[model samples]
Target: MFVECCGCKYYHDMPSNIYEAMANPEAVIRPRGNVGFTGALSMTVKCPWCSHEMSTKCCAGYAAMVYVKERLH
Candidate 1:
């Protein structure tokens, strides 16, 4: 599984179990810290390609979410 950055179209690799995450009726997927997502969501992330701040409603490690890719953009 993988995700893409809306800005750059960069693909972010996702977990193999991602299908299950989407299959669960109770599973909620939304960008982390994104107010657009209501209630407790899944993950927070940043774009490695464009250095843009981003979030996802999937399972991504915190290590992948720590880069500050903005301001330089």
Candidate 2:
């Protein structure tokens, strides 16, 4: 699936499952402009199977969780 950031033109390839995507560090972060704020921007993506539009919260949360898990291990 493809994910596009609503705040910017940034886009990424998302895995079918959140956990799987989280496993890859590179897939978790995207370059964002200096908005002088800290939070995940909303994003919309087209579903490859049905061409439906989908939305997700900030990816930062997912990345942070994964980082925490890794540190604990």
Candidate 3:
């Protein structure tokens, strides 16, 4: 999975265990200097290429799609 940075337009490859992390109730990734909830279904991380705060909606969407596919299969 990849996330696109809005500031620099860089594509970031998500971790393999991202779904597991997101599913964990205690798992919360907050970017430095950022406060408040990013979104109900999203997390925030710094862009490796540009140091910009990026939302993990792409990762979340990918996980949801994969979960649905697994359930359907």
lDDT of 3 at 42: 39
Better of 1 and 2 by lDDT: 1
TM-score of 1: 0.33
Q: Model 1 over residues 1-73: C-alpha lDDT tens digits?
A: 5566666876766553443443353556644454664665553345657775544453333224556667854
Winning candidate number (TM-score):
3
- Clashes (N, CA, C under 3 Å) per candidate: 2, 0, 0
Q: How far out, in Å, is residue 5 in model 3?
A: 0.7
Give candidate 3 misplaced runs (Cα > 4 Å): 16-44, 57-73
**How would you encode candidate 2's per-residue C-alpha lDDT over 20-57 as one tens digit per residue?**
33334235444357757776533444444555443454
- For every candidate, C-alpha RMSD to the true structure in Å: 10.5, 13.8, 11.9
Which stretches of model 2 miss by more than 4 angstroms? 19-73
Give the TM-scores of the predictions, in the order they appear.
0.33, 0.26, 0.39
Candidate 2 at residue 3, lDDT?
54
RMSD in angstroms between candidate 2 and the native structure over all alpha carbons: 13.8
Residue 69 C-alpha lDDT in model 1: 69
